[model samples]
Target chain A: MTLKAQHVSWRRGGTLVVDGVTLQPAPGSTVGLLGPNGSGKSSLLRLLQGIAKPDSGTITLDDTDLALLRRREVAQTVASVTQHADTDVDIVVRDVVRLGRTPHRSPFGGELARDERIISEALEHVGLTAKADRLWHTLSGGERQRAHIARALAQEPRELLLDEPTNHLDIRHQLELLELVAALPVTAIVALHDLNLAAMFCDTVVVLQHGRVITAGPPAEVLTPELIADVYGVRAHVTRDDYTGRPTVTFQPGPPKGEVLRPLQASTSVRSA
Target chain B: MVVGEQGRALNALTLPVAADSPSRRERQWSRYGAASVLTLGGLIVLAVSVGVAVTLGPADVSLVNVRDILLNHLGLAEIPVRVSEDAIVWQERLPRALVAAACGAGLGLCGAILQSLLRNPLADPFVLGVSSGASTGAVAVGMLGLGGSSLGLSGGAFLGALVAFGLVLLLARFASSGTSGVILAGVASTQLFSALTSLIMFAFADSDEARGVMFWLLGSLEGMRWNDVGLSTAVVGVGAIVCIASARSLDAFAFGEDVAASLGIPVARTRVLLLILTALLTATLVSIAGAVGFVGLVLPHAARLLFGQRHARVIPATIVLGAVFMVWVDAASRVAFAPTPLPVGVGTALVGVPVFVLLLLRRKGRA
Candidate 1:
């Protein structure tokens, strides 16, 4: 499904948090949103997920205005794995995932067999089948994040939005999670602070600075060292890996302030100019 | 690793073992076990309380005589050989016991709804000042002689509860910060309404009608009639249905407000409807049996311990447990001072405090 945001701008208490940013993710592809802290990545994600309304702009899913759909209808199409998913109740993993079926179930009714099948499939997809009966509070941070993903998966949504899905994951689990997300046929938009991981996994990249989209294209085109330095105020070196053929950005110390900008192109002749 | 050990321990503690289709069977068994135990325990308590309560009246009716009286009334047996014995059991103790049970269940149901709506384990109809507000209205009618006709104390209590509850909700909305804001509002409104009740009582301190006001405030099941039972049952019945219908919404609230909203729950509307239902039920109970305390506060938590945190189970379990607890408390109050009648509310407070303390201590240990 095509998820498009057109000139979306949002303000919080007179401060512009998301300035006229437009994002259009190719249908059924993984798009990563990369930004430094306070660059309004989370705010933009919320706007796309319909958790927050844009101050002035339109978000549409396949030509249907998102604002026109009921919250449940929106939820049926777009599932989210947010940063703040916690509960005090002692619910089991299966039951927690089953809550994703909330929009589909009738009020005060038991889940049908189809709902149960979907929940089982979600648990299996996240490799949490064995932990299905475990209490949520007992799970580790990584396990909890996976469980949240499993819940979103159970929604059977066409599009998934994840905010910092690898926040607490170790390297192996992070790779496994991103691989699973990339393998899924559904469209996905993920926000990440780790540019290397984004480069490795995201098919398209949207870079944000001060709540504005600075550059968006394939990762190799948009993730140049000069753009990283300008957006994040960090000097970085960029190189291509022989094995993966993907651009790898490595930060390097630069000259003191007021010195000439060291252009970090692959050709050393340009840097010596 | 310690994490692996802890995970294994949790798995063992939470999972049950079985044969064919082991995991599925285990899950089914655990759920069934939980439901059966709570149901059986509540029923046993109710039956024993009814038996003992019927036998221990001022006349010293025997257990056999109590049974005969009940059986004879139902036409399963001949009218117990004695007219006076039948009268004591049939006309007096039976109605009062039924009223106590109904009142207890009503309070418990209200408590469960309040806890879920506010997302505060400490919330209950009495603590939130709903009962106090209702009592103020009942007192006004009984002492100040407002509603001087057929409508009586109940009408006054209902009106007062409606106003107090409405004000609490309005204040909570105006504050609108979330669960904490609503809880603080309840606390403030409770104090305000309680002060008003005390002020009204003092204004009529010298009047003979003050005695009725004092007794109502203390809460009593004395002089209860079949009509009171009918009224309470009708109101509580409606409240229970409303609470059950809102169970899914209540479960949603457990994850907090934003999540519930994302799940398509109209949080504000559900909360408002619940507050109104609880207020109406509290008013009905107060008008009939006065302001019985503690049952509402303790029963829901006890129900949670027995049934887990699912509202579908908690709501019904609380109602049953509440009824049983109140019946026993009423029975104990009736017999504790043989010839003299102690108010049922005092008995409930005395009984409920220790149990509540025990539950709290147990929870602390688990934590």
Candidate 2:
């Protein structure tokens, strides 16, 4: 089943936060949502998750209209992990992950053995099995993030959506987390700020700017110097790695806007202030 | 097929309520075993407290006689007693004790729900200004003799409590910060109602009349009937069911609003419904017994420590603990001063301090 949005537009507080955006992710592919801050990436992600409805447009999952699905139906099919995870009260990691079973079971239902097995398996996938009994407050920053991942994993959705998954990770964790996401066999739409990491991990990448898609394609075609400069307002040199064959982006250290050359005389004829 | 979406949710889990703090003390027991043990202990204690508390009031009644009276009423056994003695046991102390338990359970349930729903540990049954409003209503009836004494003080107080609840929600809608905003609105409304109650008392009540009115304002379980016991028990039972049903979603709220919505919970709907439920619960009890404070605020925390923070444990545990606490507190309130009894609310406040302090210390030590 595929997830596609056609000409989606949204207005929030007098501003068109997400304007006429279209997202078409190949089924079972990891597609990156790349953008500078306030480029409507997060808002668009929210729209995809059905947390927000488009003013005009259609989001279809597996050819079914997303608007027609109940909240639990959408949740069981698509799990959205936002940018924050916390609980005011103290609880353990296992119990937190167990919440993924919410949409699957009724409020009065018992915690089935299947639920426990799935939770443990999710914890294993996130490499948090050892820390399953750890209290929520006792987790390290990265561990907490991982636990959130475990919780989402336990939801066992057909499609997973994440907003900036590596924002809190160190280099190693960012790499590990991206690697894990890339290897997973489900459709994924990840909103990422790091261009190079997106290049390395995403099978497809879509760039957003001013609430519109500036460019979208395979990383090799999408990660060019001009696209970077135009979309991010940053000048960068791009190269393809010899072995991995993915494009490597190195931003030039200077004024973000391109430095253009101008013809000048040796004599100083500049205006005096 | 569904198993692969873990990748999709990579960045989905919002802000790291950073788990930077290291484990304080590892859980000493398995949650299953601990939960079962706590449940058994709570229920047993509740039963024992109910049996023993009725015997401790001003009238002379032995624990065995109290037990026999309760068992006989339950149709479990027939241990006969004198008619007046049976009346004192069955009609007087028994219902009072039972009402105390019901009020306790209801308040505890409300406290737990509000604390979790609002993400504020200090929340209680009266956080929405229900008590203040009820007091205003009851006092007006007592002072001005409104409704000619037929509708009586409780009816007036119930109406006032409902009005205050409506106002609190009205103010909550305008508030930008959600739970804290609601609390601030409640505080403002409470002060306003309290002042109005004072104005009414000043204008209409004499010294003796004011003193009589003041007792209801403080709260009492002195005259509860079997009907009061039944109604309060029913209210608490429904509240507990609702709370338990929403337990998993409440866990989602522990993180924040975004997380809860992301989990597919109808956050706005749940919050409003729960707020209304707590308001109704508080109003019902306050109408019957003034504003018995502290039990709602303290018992939930005590339950949390005794059982864990998971609502599955917290909900049921709080109900039983609340019942146990209230029965004894009411009993003490009746017997402590002998011929001159204090209001149960006053007794609760007196005992609540040390109990709350102990809970805080235990939590700190565990941390």
Candidate 3:
């Protein structure tokens, strides 16, 4: 139940998109990966999910190198929900969730009673039980994201990786989705842009700048005004909430004064959003 | 913990459980039962269609006679019959109809697999340029006499198809990657091979030779013997098994390659194997039947409309629908022109396009 990335560096085309990054989240904890665009959050998630190997360094699950394991073996331990996961195929909500059982099912074997119960539970967890028979194309964007989460949950993986699962969600769904992920009894590494949401939900927060780890610690410790200003090139007011005792970040109205922080530059970085 | 409690409260309010509904296992079993019934029924219909179609044509053979001949050939009975009737029933029509069924089934399966693999609704067997390559090969042998009589027309066509598929693979590799690149490469190869076919026909072929090639290109089931039936049936049978076994892999491809990889499918290996399988299947069928057109393009969609989109069900359903549709289309084409015969490809398009348009409209309304 351990997933660790050691000195990982990944290059896309010619640019080092994920450079010398290391992440080791405690088991059964939710870790938030926060960075501006092209800061390697998604690329790191890809590496963590075993979709792509880091150019240098190693990714391991319980001391086993990801490359050494078969794809099925990796999938049984790790499940990922990609950003903009979509399809034009005429599949229903339940069918999408049923796909999560792929690594477990024999090719010729039908769904067993156990698989069915797990699928139902996953749908229930995502609050999609009522729309279980709805066609994928007809779902709203937020519902689609929930369906994807449900699909990942159906995999019953020990580790779950999600890239911006709340992008299409409204404010309420954003809170609810994060809450759901946090409550799940599995290790979760979420790459997100919403700083406050990450602060409220994540047990630990890791910040990336130029594909390098800037800092990693408890969100209250890591999410400082200076860190937010340095990483995102903006003035952000950080305050501890009286109720939850977590950090809250509020961006200033205008751009920063002088060259105190440089806005993210357009680069030849080939990290797909 | 308050946030978590709020989330739980929201879930309780919004996500009601359909507690009394049938479990997914029960639903899947029912679907399987339905598919089994459909397969059994399709098999029955296919056997009946072949039997009834064999009795048709200029010969006045009866359904009873066709059955008796079939049973007698299999050593179940020894009913006395006239030699000409036996030749017409056993030797001529039976093989042609059976071959048509096989071609239909194979092409439909190929279409279903390609559409899934490419994640495009428009993909089909001919999209890989195999049919055009086969055409060029047949023309080169028939018109230019390249093989002189050793490498027959079918063999030449098969070789040509493989060459075209190879060029497509090479072009897709160099030009770009992914399914779109392969499709574009296929288009380029199809145009190139089609030009070559036309050049050979116009430059070297005599008028009669040109007409003969034209008929074959339009797809004819004429003069089909038992050997064609055996070859098509064996190839298609094996291909169907391979496709059905890859059903889960195909299902994983609905969200493109990256997601499929995340789902634990070895996307590269599975894609390559399925693509090569499709190319070989398409090439073999075209070489035998000269690129019978619309069945490959239209039948899979029809199957999806009837049986939903899962490949495990879609692949088998497409095979059955394609076989039955071709049997009837070939029979109609044979009888519609009296002494002269209509090309089977043209007949399929004439029937298929309208049905395809109807399917498109129906699908659009649902969406």
Question: TM-score of predicted model 2?
Answer: 0.89
Q: Please give the lDDT score at residue A41 for candidate 1.
A: 89
* Tens-place lDDT digits, model 2, residues A189-218: 999999999999999999887687878999
Q: What is each candidate's fraction of native interface contacts (fnat)? A: 0.26, 0.42, 0.53
Which stretches of model 2 miss by more than 4 angstroms? A256-273, B1-41, B71-80, B176-178
- Order of candidates by DockQ, top first? 3, 2, 1
Q: Candidate 3, chain A: TM-score?
A: 0.94
The sequence of per-residue lDDT tens digits that candidate 1 reaches over residues B1-367 is 1354334323322333332455555555775577678778777878788778778766888888888888887889885358988878778888888889889999999888888777777787875567667877877777778878765877887777777777777887888677787777778877887888788889876666777677777788888777987888888888888787777778777667766666666666776777777877887788788888888888999888766787878988998889888988888888899677788889988998899789778867975
Ranking by lDDT: 3, 2, 1
What digit string (tens of lDDT, one per residue) describes model 3 on residues B218-270? 88898899999999999999999999999999999998887888889988789
Q: What tens-digit string does per-residue lDDT give for candidate 3 at A129-243? A: 9999999999999999999988898888789999999988999889988987888777999999999999999999999877889899999999987677567767789999999
Q: Which residue pairs of candidate 1 clash?
A: none
Give the TM-score of each candidate: 0.83, 0.89, 0.94
Candidate 3 chain B superposition, TM-score: 0.92
The Cα error of candidate 2 at residue B301, in Å, is 1.6
User: Which candidate number maximizes lDDT?
Assistant: 3
For model 3 chain A, give the 10-residue run with minimal summed lDDT: A264-273
* lDDT (Cα) of model 3: 0.88
